[model samples]
Target: MEYRSQGYKTKKCGQTVLSMITGKSVTEICKLLNKEESTSIIKDLKPFLESNGYDTSYKKVRTFEDIPNNSIVLLEFPDESLNGHFTLKVDNEFYDPSVGVISTYNKETRLPHSYLNFKKNPLKD
Candidate 1:
Protein backbone atom coordinates (compact mmCIF):
# COMPACT_ATOMS: atom_id res chain seq x y z
CA MET A 1 0.00 0.00 0.00
CA GLU A 2 1.10 3.58 -0.60
CA TYR A 3 1.98 5.86 2.26
CA ARG A 4 -0.74 8.40 3.08
CA SER A 5 0.10 11.64 4.80
CA GLN A 6 -2.19 13.37 7.32
CA GLY A 7 -0.59 16.69 6.46
CA TYR A 8 0.56 19.40 8.90
CA LYS A 9 -1.31 19.83 12.20
CA THR A 10 -4.04 17.40 11.25
CA LYS A 11 -5.64 14.78 13.48
CA LYS A 12 -6.70 12.63 10.54
CA CYS A 13 -4.26 9.83 11.19
CA GLY A 14 -7.05 7.34 11.70
CA GLN A 15 -8.77 8.42 8.53
CA THR A 16 -5.49 8.49 6.66
CA VAL A 17 -4.61 4.96 7.75
CA LEU A 18 -8.05 3.70 6.80
CA SER A 19 -7.66 5.33 3.40
CA MET A 20 -4.31 3.63 2.94
CA ILE A 21 -5.83 0.23 3.72
CA THR A 22 -9.10 0.57 1.82
CA GLY A 23 -7.90 2.75 -1.05
CA LYS A 24 -10.64 5.17 -0.10
CA SER A 25 -10.18 8.86 0.31
CA VAL A 26 -9.91 10.36 3.79
CA THR A 27 -13.15 12.25 3.25
CA GLU A 28 -14.92 9.02 2.37
CA ILE A 29 -13.61 7.34 5.51
CA CYS A 30 -14.81 10.21 7.70
CA LYS A 31 -18.25 10.00 6.14
CA LEU A 32 -18.32 6.23 6.63
CA LEU A 33 -17.56 6.75 10.32
CA ASN A 34 -19.99 9.69 10.55
CA LYS A 35 -17.26 11.94 11.79
CA GLU A 36 -16.02 15.45 11.01
CA GLU A 37 -12.44 16.08 10.01
CA SER A 38 -9.87 15.75 12.83
CA THR A 39 -12.38 13.97 15.04
CA SER A 40 -11.42 10.38 15.84
CA ILE A 41 -13.70 7.43 15.40
CA ILE A 42 -11.12 4.81 16.19
CA LYS A 43 -13.61 2.96 18.37
CA ASP A 44 -15.55 2.19 15.21
CA LEU A 45 -12.54 0.99 13.23
CA LYS A 46 -12.73 -2.74 13.99
CA PRO A 47 -16.40 -3.10 13.12
CA PHE A 48 -15.90 -1.14 9.91
CA LEU A 49 -12.96 -3.27 8.78
CA GLU A 50 -14.78 -6.49 9.67
CA SER A 51 -17.80 -5.39 7.71
CA ASN A 52 -15.56 -4.68 4.74
CA GLY A 53 -14.37 -8.31 4.41
CA TYR A 54 -11.33 -8.07 6.61
CA ASP A 55 -10.60 -10.62 9.32
CA THR A 56 -9.35 -8.49 12.16
CA SER A 57 -7.66 -9.09 15.51
CA TYR A 58 -6.48 -6.60 18.10
CA LYS A 59 -3.83 -7.06 20.82
CA LYS A 60 -1.65 -5.12 23.21
CA VAL A 61 2.12 -5.56 23.22
CA ARG A 62 5.10 -4.40 25.25
CA THR A 63 7.76 -4.31 22.55
CA PHE A 64 8.06 -3.94 18.79
CA GLU A 65 9.16 -7.58 18.65
CA ASP A 66 5.77 -8.55 20.08
CA ILE A 67 4.08 -7.05 17.03
CA PRO A 68 3.66 -9.41 14.11
CA ASN A 69 5.50 -8.56 10.91
CA ASN A 70 2.44 -7.49 8.93
CA SER A 71 -0.11 -5.54 10.95
CA ILE A 72 -1.62 -2.14 11.68
CA VAL A 73 -0.09 -0.82 14.87
CA LEU A 74 -1.49 1.88 17.14
CA LEU A 75 1.35 3.81 18.66
CA GLU A 76 0.83 5.90 21.77
CA PHE A 77 2.61 9.19 21.93
CA PRO A 78 3.81 10.96 25.07
CA ASP A 79 0.94 13.41 24.83
CA GLU A 80 -2.02 12.28 26.89
CA SER A 81 -4.77 14.15 25.09
CA LEU A 82 -4.19 13.03 21.52
CA ASN A 83 -5.42 9.62 20.53
CA GLY A 84 -2.95 7.00 19.36
CA HIS A 85 -1.51 7.06 15.85
CA PHE A 86 -1.78 4.24 13.33
CA THR A 87 0.93 2.84 11.09
CA LEU A 88 1.17 -0.16 8.77
CA LYS A 89 4.06 -2.55 9.13
CA VAL A 90 4.77 -4.99 6.37
CA ASP A 91 7.81 -7.11 7.10
CA ASN A 92 10.66 -4.73 7.93
CA GLU A 93 9.14 -1.54 6.55
CA PHE A 94 6.93 0.82 8.50
CA TYR A 95 4.45 2.95 6.56
CA ASP A 96 3.60 5.90 8.76
CA PRO A 97 0.85 8.21 7.58
CA SER A 98 2.53 11.22 9.15
CA VAL A 99 6.01 10.48 7.87
CA GLY A 100 6.76 8.31 4.86
CA VAL A 101 8.38 4.89 5.06
CA ILE A 102 10.62 4.16 8.02
CA SER A 103 12.91 1.21 8.74
CA THR A 104 12.75 1.26 12.55
CA TYR A 105 10.19 1.94 15.25
CA ASN A 106 12.73 4.15 17.02
CA LYS A 107 12.23 6.73 14.27
CA GLU A 108 8.89 7.43 15.93
CA THR A 109 8.89 8.82 19.45
CA ARG A 110 5.58 7.05 20.04
CA LEU A 111 5.60 3.57 21.58
CA PRO A 112 3.73 0.65 20.13
CA HIS A 113 0.80 0.14 22.47
CA SER A 114 -1.36 -2.22 20.47
CA TYR A 115 -1.95 -3.58 17.01
CA LEU A 116 -4.77 -4.61 14.70
CA ASN A 117 -3.99 -7.51 12.40
CA PHE A 118 -6.08 -7.88 9.29
CA LYS A 119 -6.33 -9.91 6.13
CA LYS A 120 -9.00 -10.33 3.50
CA ASN A 121 -11.49 -13.06 4.38
CA PRO A 122 -11.39 -15.73 1.68
CA LEU A 123 -15.11 -16.34 1.97
CA LYS A 124 -15.77 -12.67 1.35
CA ASP A 125 -13.36 -12.58 -1.52
Candidate 2:
Protein backbone atom coordinates (compact mmCIF):
# COMPACT_ATOMS: atom_id res chain seq x y z
CA MET A 1 0.00 0.00 0.00
CA GLU A 2 2.66 2.53 -1.10
CA TYR A 3 2.02 5.19 -3.71
CA ARG A 4 3.93 8.31 -4.79
CA SER A 5 2.26 11.02 -6.89
CA GLN A 6 3.39 13.82 -9.20
CA GLY A 7 5.19 13.19 -12.53
CA TYR A 8 5.73 9.49 -11.79
CA LYS A 9 4.34 6.90 -9.40
CA THR A 10 5.79 4.03 -7.40
CA LYS A 11 3.04 1.63 -6.46
CA LYS A 12 1.75 -1.86 -6.98
CA CYS A 13 -1.81 -2.05 -8.12
CA GLY A 14 -3.59 -5.26 -7.37
CA GLN A 15 -4.94 -7.20 -10.36
CA THR A 16 -2.01 -7.18 -12.74
CA VAL A 17 -2.41 -6.48 -16.44
CA LEU A 18 0.85 -8.13 -17.54
CA SER A 19 -0.46 -11.64 -16.96
CA MET A 20 -3.70 -10.63 -18.61
CA ILE A 21 -1.78 -9.47 -21.64
CA THR A 22 0.04 -12.78 -21.93
CA GLY A 23 -3.03 -14.68 -20.81
CA LYS A 24 -1.51 -15.88 -17.56
CA SER A 25 -2.27 -14.72 -13.98
CA VAL A 26 0.26 -16.50 -11.77
CA THR A 27 -0.61 -14.32 -8.77
CA GLU A 28 3.01 -14.81 -7.84
CA ILE A 29 4.07 -13.11 -11.07
CA CYS A 30 4.52 -9.79 -9.31
CA LYS A 31 4.05 -10.83 -5.71
CA LEU A 32 6.90 -8.68 -4.40
CA LEU A 33 6.91 -5.92 -7.00
CA ASN A 34 6.89 -2.17 -6.85
CA LYS A 35 6.02 -1.19 -10.36
CA GLU A 36 6.39 2.23 -11.98
CA GLU A 37 3.37 4.20 -13.15
CA SER A 38 3.68 3.09 -16.79
CA THR A 39 2.21 -0.25 -15.74
CA SER A 40 -1.49 -0.36 -15.03
CA ILE A 41 -2.67 0.49 -11.53
CA ILE A 42 -6.09 0.67 -13.24
CA LYS A 43 -8.26 0.94 -10.13
CA ASP A 44 -6.94 4.14 -8.52
CA LEU A 45 -5.60 6.38 -11.21
CA LYS A 46 -6.85 9.77 -12.22
CA PRO A 47 -7.93 10.65 -15.73
CA PHE A 48 -7.12 7.05 -16.69
CA LEU A 49 -6.14 7.60 -20.26
CA GLU A 50 -5.43 11.16 -21.15
CA SER A 51 -6.79 12.20 -24.50
CA ASN A 52 -4.43 15.14 -24.51
CA GLY A 53 -1.34 14.70 -22.35
CA TYR A 54 1.56 17.05 -23.02
CA ASP A 55 5.07 17.53 -21.63
CA THR A 56 7.96 19.69 -22.87
CA SER A 57 11.32 21.09 -21.88
CA TYR A 58 14.03 23.57 -22.92
CA LYS A 59 17.23 21.84 -23.98
CA LYS A 60 20.35 23.22 -25.62
CA VAL A 61 20.82 20.63 -28.28
CA ARG A 62 24.21 20.37 -29.88
CA THR A 63 24.95 22.14 -33.18
CA PHE A 64 23.40 19.38 -35.21
CA GLU A 65 22.75 19.68 -38.95
CA ASP A 66 19.03 19.88 -38.26
CA ILE A 67 19.11 23.39 -36.88
CA PRO A 68 17.30 25.63 -39.36
CA ASN A 69 18.07 29.17 -40.38
CA ASN A 70 15.98 32.35 -40.01
CA SER A 71 12.89 30.45 -38.88
CA ILE A 72 12.69 28.90 -35.40
CA VAL A 73 12.02 25.24 -34.76
CA LEU A 74 9.92 25.10 -31.63
CA LEU A 75 10.55 21.57 -30.40
CA GLU A 76 8.26 20.16 -27.73
CA PHE A 77 10.86 19.19 -25.15
CA PRO A 78 10.40 16.48 -22.53
CA ASP A 79 9.36 18.71 -19.57
CA GLU A 80 6.29 20.28 -21.28
CA SER A 81 7.23 23.94 -21.18
CA LEU A 82 5.87 26.11 -24.00
CA ASN A 83 7.60 29.29 -22.96
CA GLY A 84 10.85 29.07 -24.93
CA HIS A 85 11.81 28.78 -28.58
CA PHE A 86 14.36 26.53 -30.25
CA THR A 87 16.23 26.89 -33.52
CA LEU A 88 17.04 23.56 -35.19
CA LYS A 89 18.76 23.39 -38.58
CA VAL A 90 18.00 21.18 -41.50
CA ASP A 91 19.09 20.76 -45.11
CA ASN A 92 15.66 21.80 -46.37
CA GLU A 93 12.66 23.29 -44.63
CA PHE A 94 10.24 20.53 -43.79
CA TYR A 95 6.78 20.57 -42.26
CA ASP A 96 6.12 18.14 -39.40
CA PRO A 97 2.40 17.90 -38.73
CA SER A 98 2.95 15.42 -35.89
CA VAL A 99 4.52 18.09 -33.64
CA GLY A 100 1.49 20.39 -34.02
CA VAL A 101 3.59 22.82 -36.05
CA ILE A 102 1.64 22.77 -39.34
CA SER A 103 -1.92 21.86 -38.48
CA THR A 104 -5.00 21.46 -40.66
CA TYR A 105 -7.01 24.26 -39.06
CA ASN A 106 -6.78 26.85 -36.32
CA LYS A 107 -9.37 26.30 -33.62
CA GLU A 108 -10.65 28.62 -30.89
CA THR A 109 -10.44 25.91 -28.21
CA ARG A 110 -7.21 25.15 -26.37
CA LEU A 111 -6.48 21.64 -27.64
CA PRO A 112 -7.48 18.74 -29.90
CA HIS A 113 -7.01 20.85 -33.03
CA SER A 114 -9.21 20.38 -36.10
CA TYR A 115 -6.80 18.02 -37.87
CA LEU A 116 -6.55 15.70 -34.87
CA ASN A 117 -10.21 14.70 -35.00
CA PHE A 118 -10.74 11.14 -36.17
CA LYS A 119 -13.92 10.51 -38.14
CA LYS A 120 -15.80 7.23 -37.98
CA ASN A 121 -19.16 6.08 -39.52
CA PRO A 122 -20.99 9.39 -39.86
CA LEU A 123 -21.69 11.71 -36.98
CA LYS A 124 -21.35 15.45 -37.34
CA ASP A 125 -20.79 17.53 -34.22
Candidate 3:
Protein backbone atom coordinates (compact mmCIF):
# COMPACT_ATOMS: atom_id res chain seq x y z
CA MET A 1 0.00 0.00 0.00
CA GLU A 2 1.25 3.46 -0.92
CA TYR A 3 0.44 6.07 1.76
CA ARG A 4 1.51 9.70 1.68
CA SER A 5 1.83 11.62 4.97
CA GLN A 6 -0.04 14.86 5.33
CA GLY A 7 -1.81 17.13 7.82
CA TYR A 8 -1.78 15.68 11.34
CA LYS A 9 -0.84 12.22 10.15
CA THR A 10 2.74 12.45 11.20
CA LYS A 11 2.92 8.77 11.98
CA LYS A 12 1.77 7.70 8.54
CA CYS A 13 5.09 5.94 8.04
CA GLY A 14 4.21 3.43 10.75
CA GLN A 15 0.75 3.14 9.28
CA THR A 16 2.27 2.27 5.91
CA VAL A 17 4.32 -0.49 7.47
CA LEU A 18 1.29 -1.89 9.25
CA SER A 19 -0.75 -1.73 6.07
CA MET A 20 1.86 -3.67 4.09
CA ILE A 21 2.49 -6.22 6.81
CA THR A 22 -1.15 -6.82 7.61
CA GLY A 23 -2.61 -6.28 4.13
CA LYS A 24 -5.15 -3.91 5.67
CA SER A 25 -6.40 -0.62 4.39
CA VAL A 26 -6.19 2.64 6.32
CA THR A 27 -9.94 2.93 6.48
CA GLU A 28 -10.30 -0.58 7.87
CA ILE A 29 -7.70 0.13 10.48
CA CYS A 30 -9.40 3.32 11.47
CA LYS A 31 -12.68 1.51 11.91
CA LEU A 32 -11.06 -1.30 13.84
CA LEU A 33 -9.64 1.02 16.48
CA ASN A 34 -11.89 4.02 16.09
CA LYS A 35 -8.83 6.21 15.70
CA GLU A 36 -8.49 8.99 13.16
CA GLU A 37 -5.22 10.53 14.23
CA SER A 38 -1.82 9.28 13.18
CA THR A 39 -0.43 9.49 16.69
CA SER A 40 -3.25 7.32 18.02
CA ILE A 41 -2.65 4.78 15.28
CA ILE A 42 1.02 4.54 16.09
CA LYS A 43 0.44 4.34 19.82
CA ASP A 44 -2.03 1.48 19.45
CA LEU A 45 0.00 -0.49 16.88
CA LYS A 46 1.96 -2.70 19.25
CA PRO A 47 -1.07 -3.72 21.28
CA PHE A 48 -3.11 -4.34 18.17
CA LEU A 49 -0.45 -6.64 16.77
CA GLU A 50 -0.01 -8.38 20.07
CA SER A 51 -3.71 -9.11 20.35
CA ASN A 52 -3.62 -10.50 16.82
CA GLY A 53 -0.89 -12.97 17.89
CA TYR A 54 2.09 -11.08 16.53
CA ASP A 55 5.21 -10.57 18.60
CA THR A 56 6.91 -7.23 18.18
CA SER A 57 10.20 -5.69 19.17
CA TYR A 58 12.59 -2.87 18.42
CA LYS A 59 16.30 -3.10 17.71
CA LYS A 60 18.82 -0.35 17.47
CA VAL A 61 20.39 -0.30 14.03
CA ARG A 62 23.71 1.46 14.02
CA THR A 63 24.73 0.39 10.55
CA PHE A 64 23.12 -0.95 7.40
CA GLU A 65 24.96 -4.28 7.51
CA ASP A 66 22.65 -6.50 9.57
CA ILE A 67 19.32 -5.09 8.41
CA PRO A 68 17.40 -7.25 5.97
CA ASN A 69 15.01 -6.26 3.23
CA ASN A 70 11.45 -5.29 4.19
CA SER A 71 12.68 -4.16 7.57
CA ILE A 72 10.84 -1.25 9.18
CA VAL A 73 13.08 1.41 10.68
CA LEU A 74 12.14 4.58 12.55
CA LEU A 75 13.96 7.70 11.56
CA GLU A 76 13.67 11.44 10.90
CA PHE A 77 13.93 13.20 7.59
CA PRO A 78 15.97 16.28 6.73
CA ASP A 79 13.12 18.70 7.27
CA GLU A 80 11.58 17.01 10.29
CA SER A 81 14.12 17.11 13.05
CA LEU A 82 12.05 16.30 16.13
CA ASN A 83 9.84 13.51 14.92
CA GLY A 84 11.02 9.95 14.32
CA HIS A 85 9.39 8.61 11.20
CA PHE A 86 9.11 5.02 10.12
CA THR A 87 9.84 3.52 6.65
CA LEU A 88 10.32 0.14 5.05
CA LYS A 89 13.74 -0.67 3.68
CA VAL A 90 13.88 -2.89 0.62
CA ASP A 91 17.38 -3.72 -0.57
CA ASN A 92 19.16 -0.35 -0.73
CA GLU A 93 16.01 1.65 -1.31
CA PHE A 94 13.51 3.04 1.19
CA TYR A 95 9.75 3.34 0.83
CA ASP A 96 8.87 6.33 2.97
CA PRO A 97 5.32 7.42 3.64
CA SER A 98 6.36 10.99 4.31
CA VAL A 99 7.38 11.11 0.68
CA GLY A 100 5.51 9.71 -2.28
CA VAL A 101 8.33 7.53 -3.78
CA ILE A 102 11.10 5.09 -3.12
CA SER A 103 14.43 6.69 -2.32
CA THR A 104 17.88 5.23 -2.78
CA TYR A 105 20.12 5.09 0.25
CA ASN A 106 23.23 7.14 -0.37
CA LYS A 107 25.65 9.60 1.19
CA GLU A 108 23.91 12.74 0.02
CA THR A 109 20.54 11.77 1.45
CA ARG A 110 22.19 9.88 4.32
CA LEU A 111 20.48 7.73 6.95
CA PRO A 112 18.73 9.27 9.91
CA HIS A 113 20.25 9.45 13.36
CA SER A 114 19.28 7.12 16.23
CA TYR A 115 17.27 4.60 14.28
CA LEU A 116 14.84 2.30 16.06
CA ASN A 117 14.30 -0.77 13.95
CA PHE A 118 10.74 -2.14 14.15
CA LYS A 119 10.24 -5.88 13.85
CA LYS A 120 7.18 -8.11 14.11
CA ASN A 121 6.16 -11.70 13.41
CA PRO A 122 3.75 -14.40 14.50
CA LEU A 123 3.91 -15.39 18.13
CA LYS A 124 3.65 -19.06 17.32
CA ASP A 125 6.79 -19.01 15.26
Displacement of residue 47 (Cα, Å) in model 3 is 2.7
- For residues 1-125, write the lDDT of model 2, one tens digit per residue: 11111112322222222222222232433442333332322221111212113111222333223243322233333344443222112233323312212322222212220111111112221
Each candidate: what lDDT?
Answer: 0.77, 0.25, 0.56
**What's the best-to-worst order under TM-score?**
1, 3, 2
Residue 99, model 2, lDDT: 28
Q: Candidate 3: list runs displaced more than 4 Å.
A: 1-11, 40-42, 90-93, 100-103, 106-110, 113-125
Q: Which stretches of candidate 2 lie over 4 Å from their true place?
A: 1-15, 32-125
Model 2 score (lDDT): 0.25
lDDT per residue for candidate 1 within 9-64, as digits (tens), equals 78777777778888898889889988655433247667778888888888888688
As a TM-score, model 1 comes out at: 0.86
> Which candidate leads the pack in lDDT?
1
- Candidate 1 residue runs with Cα over 4 Å from true position: 37-42, 79-82
RMSD of each: 2.3, 17.7, 4.2
Shift in Å, residue 99, candidate 3 = 3.8
Instruction: Estimate, for each residue in 13-121, the C-alpha lDDT of model 3 and write its tens digit.
Output: 5555666656687666667766665542235666665655566554566555555665666664556666566666655566666665465555345454433334455
Note the residue pairs that clash in candidate 1. Answer: none
Better of 1 and 2 by lDDT: 1
